[model samples]
Target: MKILITGGAGFVGQALRRALGNAHTLTILDTAPAPADLGPSTRWIEASILDEAALREAFAGQQAVFHLAAALGVRACQEREDIVEQVNVGGMRAVIAAAVATPSVEHLLFTSSSEIYGDGEPGQIFREQDEPAPRSAYARSKIASEELMAAAAASPEGARLSYTVFRLFNAYGPGQRADFVIPAFCRAALQGEAPVVHGDGLQTRTFTFIDDIAAAMVSALDARAPAKAAGSLEVFNLVSEETLTIASLAQLVCLSAGERPRVLHRDHEDPAVGRSKRFEVTRRVADNRKARAALGFRPTTPLSEGVRRTLDSVRAGSGAAEARG
Candidate 1:
């Protein structure tokens, strides 16, 4: 199958390319330059999702399109609401306009985030059926994009679109930006610095490894995959079980990196910067029963193992970065 991965040079995009690149004809679309070390067989198209002409050309003769392009994180969206909305929400509108109309596009997998769940009900395993209560601009943008996909589902080309939305939980692994928790903690641990914690370190989240997320996406792309056509528009929560606290998580990263745990807790919630406003989800956990029953999605990587691999990657990356510097 011929696949086009938007944001193909991103952390998740690179991991997806590695997971599915060998088996399929892979084309990467992004504004950033293609990674220098990408495989020779991989095709790279440097362009933005907002480019209608480029979308028209890229969507032609594509079997599957992984729509992963978006503003990076909650903090980023908070800092640049206007630009992030255009990129996160508006980009979806543009992609749907271009992709759904393309006859060759059978399946378009969109990467949504669990942020849409917001500060969910007090004690509920966030299920697909639960009402979405978006808390921040980032979370709201995610829901907005999902609604756009829903709109496309009712459009004239709905049948041809075959859109799939995977609402991801906290995804982390190597190549992830250092701003994220795992990498940040890893860098701090490696440097023997006390990593700064955003809150009181009580908030919980389900962190899925990049490889597992890529594997799930690969499975979802398969036409005969068990997860296909569960509904006209399908949404799955891609995550692992929540098994650690932010404080524990910092310690775990230190342990993974073979360092002493000396985490510094702080409240980086600055209203002026909109950091607290954007990251409103105090605790995030999901129920994967729907995914398991339909997609046969079973996450295999344990936290300890995932952290070890991430630490290894962080170490390598920091070393390479230092060498370059």
Candidate 2:
């Protein structure tokens, strides 16, 4: 299939490339420059998601599009609220329009975040049916984007839209940015510095490996697998059952990096200064049964192994961009 991935140069996007590049003709539509080693079948187009002409050009002859472009990360969203709505919300609209306008386009798989279910209690379980409590502008923008796609499909442009929403929990692996928890812990461990834990160290999250995330995404391409609701619109949580506390992950990273992890607990008055994203949830565990039955979505990589791999990759690419991946 011919495919286009917005924000295709970023970490998760790169993972998708590694997963699906061999089988499909891939075109990357992103404002960022192309990566060094995009294969022969893959091409890069320098454009933002907000550009309709650019998106239309890229969407041409494409059978599917993975909408990964956005103001990523909680901090970036919190810091840039005005632009987040413009990009996250407006960008989805542009992508949908481009897809609808294009004759060949059939499927669109959006990579939404777990942050859409914000402010859950400690060890709280999250399901797709839960009402979204978006605490930040970022999560709210994602909610709006999901709604936009659903509403658009129910409209006149209903037939060609094969839309799926994946609410991805904490995905960690090689080439992750330092702003993320795994990379930060690994970097601190490598440098023998104290890793900071925002709020209580007991806060837990399910961290799925980047490779597993990519695999789940690739499997989502099987249009027969997703829910047959609303004429094939599906929403699934892409996450692992492996849950760990923030402090525990830090300690694991330290051990993996050959250092004894000393976790420093800090409760700050300003949430922006804290490592935790502003108004973020304390715990989020995904229900992956739907993904497993629908898309054969399974994450096999162990957390300890994933941490080791991330540490090695980060150490090798220390001078690269921060908080990306």
Candidate 3:
């Protein structure tokens, strides 16, 4: 397949590039260029997703376009709401429009977020059928983008475009930004600094491995699934069934680093943080059954193993700490 991936410099994009390099003709478009060591088979184009002309040019001759570019990171999104909205929602609109305009683009895979199910009622595993109740600005923006993509796919112009929207949940592994929980904890613990545990550290999350996510994306691309049927959009939640609390993860980080650091909760005056959270992921876990039947999708990496691999990568890329502010 001739594939075009946006945000190809980002963690997930890098993983996909490595996984699909030999099997497909890949063209990556992003606001920044990829690393110098990127494979020869992968072509890089530096362009913003909001640039419709650039996106159109990138979409030309592409069989599938993975729309992964977006303003990400909880801290970044919380600080820059306008920029996040513009780049995430507006940029997604541009990508969908460009795909609709290009006849050869058969599939457009959009990476959505599990944040849309924000703070569900206790013990409710976020199912695909639940109505979205977004809490943060970032979550709202993602919901808007998902709606936009669904609308575009239902239009006459988008009749031929195949859409696969995956609502990914807490994907972690090497190459993840330092601002993220896993990488932040790994970097701090590796540097002999105490891993910062925000609030009381009881917030829970499901951390999916980057490799499993890439594999799921490939499966979705190759599956015979309809983007929408019966006036509703088809969506899949890509996440691990395993759940871990922030405190537990911090302890694990300390263990992985061969050091036990004291957990320091932020001061009450430092803005209230770490709201207790969980997602009703029941249907999401069940949807894997559908993926398995249709696409032969299966998550192979366990959390402990994935964390060990992430720690190893952090050790190898210790220079990343210098890049941190």
Candidate 4:
């Protein structure tokens, strides 16, 4: 199969590339320069998703499309909602238009965030059918994009396009940017700095490993098409069973690095801290039973083991850079 992945240079994109291996002819479309080590079966297109011409060109002759490009991160999106809307929503519109026009494209996979669940009460599990309570700009953008995907699939022009939406939970692992919680904690622990805990440190999230995310994404390619003759739209909650508090996650990272757990609690809205946004979701845990039954998705990594591996990878990467220098 020939696959075209938007934002293929990102953290999750690189992981998916590894999972794809040499099985598929891969084309990566991103603004970033192509990775020096990309496989022979892979080619890179340096462009933005908002470029309709570029999207059409990339979608040409492709059997599948993985739409991963977007303006990510809560704080970043909050600060620049306009850009978020432009990239997230506008990009999806462009991708759909291109896919609808393309003849060879069969399936399109979209990565939606679990942040759309908003602030759920403790023990409240988010299901696929649950109404979205998006609190932030980024979350709202994702929900909007999701609606666009469904609408596009049901459109007459998109009758042949099959689409899948994977509502991804907090995905953390090596190569994740430091702005994220897990990698931030790991970096602080490795640098001998106290991990910063925003708010009360009780905000909960279901952290899925990057490998599991990649595997589930790759498995979707083999999934059966929707029975509907016009088109098909499927939504699955892609997450692991592990749920942990922010403070607890910090402690786990410290322990993984063989360091004492010393955390620095700060107001999420504090400008001095200059990271987290004012509005933060209290709890977000998704029910993955539908995904388990439909896609045979079972996340295998435990929180402790995943944390250890992430820390080790960071250390190894730093050591390799030092050696090269």
Candidate 5:
């Protein structure tokens, strides 16, 4: 299959590149310049997803499109909702429009975030059917994008565009950005600084490895798209069963670095901290049974192993750009 991944220069996109390997012809559309190690079968297009002409040109001759380009991170989204709206929401509109106009594009897969299922009750595992309670602007943008995708598929113009929405949980791995929890903890641990915890530190999240996320996403290509009442669409929670508190993850990262755990608790809402008060997801976990049965999605990396590898990558001077993706 000929595939096009928007924001393919990022960490998760690079993992998807590895997973796809030479099996498919891959084209990347991103604002970032092409990486030094571009694959033999991959082509890089340094363009923004919000550019309709660029999207139309990129969508040409592609069988599948992975929509991954967006303004990521809770803090970033909270700080600049304007840019987030432009990239996440407006960019999605461009992608959808381009895909609809393209004849060769059969499938459109979007990388939605698990943050949409905000503030779940204790032990509340989220399903695709669960109602979304988005907290931050980022989460709201994702929800809006998902709705747009669904609407496009259900529309008469988008009859040929079958779509999949992969609501990915906390993704952490070797090349991830330090802004995320795992890499941040590892970096702090290596630097002999206290692991910083936002909010009460008791907030829980299920971390999925980058490799596992890529695998699940690729598996969706071969899986059957069951008919839905709404449209020719499928939604899966690409997550692992491993769940932990923010405080525990910090401790784990510190211990993995062979140091005693020292945690620094910070107010997520403090203006001095430069974080959004809307970072309100107290507990976020997902039910991956649908993905397991439908896409054979099984996350193998344990949190300990993942943290160790992330630490190693950080110590080896892995750049932040890769992680930010």
Candidate 6:
């Protein structure tokens, strides 16, 4: 398929490029110019998603669009609300508009977040039927974007566009930014420095591997349209069934680093403060039944194995950095 992926230079984008390189013609659009290492089959365009003309140009002749570009990172979004709103919401508007305008585009996948679930009860797993109670500014922005995409899909103009929304959980693996929990812990542990654990480290999360996420995305893109056709919009939760506490994750990182490092419990307040203590994702386990029934989606990697692979990649990258220095 001829595919256009926005934010195609980011971590997940890089993985997608590596995974789909040989099979598909790929074009990447980002605010920054294309990196020097982009593959020969891939074309890069320098433009933000907010630019309607640029987005239109990028959408031309593409059979599918993967709208992965967004202002991400909880901490970063907490600090820059205005920029997050503009890039996350405004940019999505432009992308959806361009995709609907282009007659050749068959499928458009918008990457949403599990944070839209906000603070659920500790034992309850979030499902598609559950109401969204967004807490943070970032979550609110994502919720807004999802609504926009749904609205666009329902419109008469969007009849030809197939829409799939993925509510991604905590995705971790190599090439992820160091600001996130896993990478941050890995870097600190490797340096023999105490890793910081915020908020008593009791928060539990389902960390989805990057490879699984990419696989799910590909499946969602290729799924057949439903027969009833209320515009054929589907939402899937992309995640692993395993839920690990932050404290346990920290210890695992220490073990991976081959060192028992100190964990400093910082008093940093959660952005979703006073909202809820524990999120009960009882159904936190992704009911891949919907996805599997529709698009042969299955998560193959175990959590421990994925973590080991991530640690290995981090160590290798660290070694490279040391050699360069």
**Best-fitting candidate, scored by lDDT:** 4
TM-score of each candidate structure, all chains considered together: 0.93, 0.93, 0.88, 0.96, 0.93, 0.91
Query: Cα lDDT of all candidates, in order?
Result: 0.81, 0.84, 0.77, 0.88, 0.87, 0.79
Q: Candidate 6: worst 10 consecutive residues by lDDT?
A: 274-283
* Per-residue lDDT of candidate 2, residues 1-325 (tens digit): 8999999988899899999958899999999887787689998999998887888789989988899999987767888899998999989988888888887887888999999998777557888888999988889999999998888667766555678898988988987767888888888888899788886788788999999989989987874332343335678898998998898888888888889767987775556555444575677886888888988888899898888889889888765544365
Per-residue lDDT of candidate 3, residues 204-253 (tens digit): 77788999988888876667333433233467877777787777887788
Residue pairs with backbone atoms closer than 3 Å in model 3 (clashes): 124-280, 125-280, 125-281, 125-282, 126-280, 126-281
lDDT head-to-head 1 vs 2, winner: 2
TM-score of 4: 0.96
Report the Cα RMSD per candidate: 2.4, 3.1, 3.8, 1.6, 3.2, 3.3
Query: lDDT by residue for model 6 over 169-273, one digit each (tens)?
Result: 888898898778788888888888777776677777888889988887876655643233336678888877788778788888888778784687765555533
Query: Among all windows of ten consecutive residues in candidate 3, which has the lowest summed lDDT?
Result: 277-286
Greater lDDT among 1 and 4 belongs to 4
lDDT for each residue of candidate 5 in 1-325, tens digit (9 for 90 to 100): 9999999988889889899889999999999999888878888899999777788778889988999999998877888999999999999998989888888888889999998888889778899999998888899999999999989988999966679999989988988876777888898998889998887889888999999999989988777432322248889999999888899999999999999998998998766667655566788988899999988998999988988888989987745545776
> Which candidate do you rate higher for TM-score, 4 or 5?
4
- Name the lDDT value of residue 60 in candidate 6: 97
Query: Which one wins by TM-score: 2 or 4?
Result: 4
